[model samples]
Target: MERLLINIKISVNEKIYLKDPESSDLGKRILKHSIELIHSIGFECFNFKKLGKEIGSNESSIYRYFENKHKLLLYLTSWYWGWLEYKLVFSTNGISNPKNQLIKAIEIICDVIREDSRFSHINEVKLSKILIAEYSKSYLTKEVDDENKEGYFSIYKRLIIRIKEMIGQVNPKYQYPASLASSIVEGALHQHFLREHFPLITDCSDTKTTTSFYSDLVLKTIQK
Candidate 1:
């Protein structure tokens, strides 16, 4: 699994960018510094000019990869989903029990992220924070319908589908596996945000508690 993840090349939709960021060193530097900029300032405030200054490049260089900050956000978030799906596969490999696999999947999405040295340029921890604070913006825009048509969200949707399949295996009679699966992922992010800003709204104050809350929530919802 580690070998697979290290070698995994997650393909992003061509429509999202003018050029592939993984295709060259400059492009990879753009991703590396862009992650730092977004993690420091935020998605709303991050722009190509700022990123260019941070990476010691011109705005045109950044534009060579992404058309706009929105597309860049899409790329980053899409990459994260693909990486997460990889982790999900790795975490659940050879686990025949569907319930156990489902539990592990929940934990992967809900728990604190550990930095993977394999992706040295991409900080999993910072990316996870961006996901918690900014993932919705990637899809909440008016262009989402058109982007969806172009498979911009294929990786994310695929992850949800994988977990939805596990839910079906656990509870063959459960009629809302898709909805339940999506809820688990989105709810985990929301719960994380609440834990940080509105602690009283959620029971997730730390990694262990957050993992327990989500794991129990999914098990009870599907297994009941």
Candidate 2:
């Protein structure tokens, strides 16, 4: 950083870090441009030099926030998951019935993917692979790979357990545990939104259709 800025006689302003991160407005802007650029061309091909040139910033600016390409992708992927956790928490409150909760979870996931183009199978598959691969190492740094692991997982677990209990209520002789039901539910939703089921349903562009289909399918599948 010092070497690159030295040629232009630019000095590091400690106020940016020592004072307020908001002071690094240029750095923040560069990060935004970096996200846009990577989203367009993909993280594999996005070039900070080009991004800086297009955004009217220096290459050093992007590098200031992100050390390299890998770090940039990590930040972008993490940001998407962070937004997902928020939507999940907001979407499934006051709906405590296990059946309703499970349906709501699928519905909310579909609605979220509809709103974010990056939530497509391409990004979903990529992010899944990345998360699975990094989960061991990332969890070592904290309790989970994603930042809001406990907050989201607790509600999610409760919802799943409740759903399985509801299923058992309908079919008292069912042998499998609720945790297995949760796995099935999560897996089904993931397949639908992130795979072949998506392209077949163009009407699902709206949240209504998305949630409706998800809810109907979930209810039907869980019905005894």
Candidate 3:
């Protein structure tokens, strides 16, 4: 699955569209079209010709911005992370203290999962499997680095660091929770969004209310 991820990275730049939101650049125009197409038609149903027609561009023009569909999917997913990171960073303001920051961290991550239906757009485990497949098939492009997926990773690193940091602050000598505190919280959150929401409309295992219940449990666990 990871191999599929790397196999898909065709080179393109984000600024091609941002340079001018209106009639600015071919690259930007195609990128904007690509995102809208994916969101509207979904990953499985999207096609270049249909996308180009909708955007009033030719198929080759769309391909000029992205080599193919899968690569576009990768870029779009990464783009979401960029937007998310911006919100999270500003929301938390970089608190160094662990306990004080943990709540902010939880709020930042959970709020995104709950309020945004974006998570429902793709299956994370399947994507993770695809990421693993891509790694198996080939290596990631060098350009896909710190900025590429920082939004997704930074949240994980921040929580883990703060988990241990707060554990220490609360206990003065904290051991990593036997449960691996970070994963427990993240896993529960994932379940609420990924499995709990729908009977068949979603992969969610339980029901939508699971989020509220999980939130309360997490709060008590982290309470000082």
Stretches of candidate 2 off by over 4 Å are 1-23, 112-213
Query: Worst lDDT window (10 residues) for model 3?
Result: 130-139
Evaluation by lDDT, superior candidate among 1 and 3? 1
lDDT of candidates 1 onward, in order: 0.89, 0.50, 0.48
Which ranges of candidate 1 are over 4 A from the true structure? none
Write down the worst ten-residue block by lDDT for model 1.
1-10
Rank all candidate structures by their TM-score, best first, as comma-separated numbers. 1, 3, 2
Q: Model 3, residue 142: displacement in angstroms? A: 18
Candidate 3 deviant stretches above 4 angstroms: 1-25, 94-97, 112-215, 219-224
lDDT head-to-head 1 vs 2, winner = 1
- Candidate 1, residue 58: Cα displacement in angstroms equals 0.9
Q: Which ten residues in a row have the lowest lDDT in candidate 2?
A: 9-18
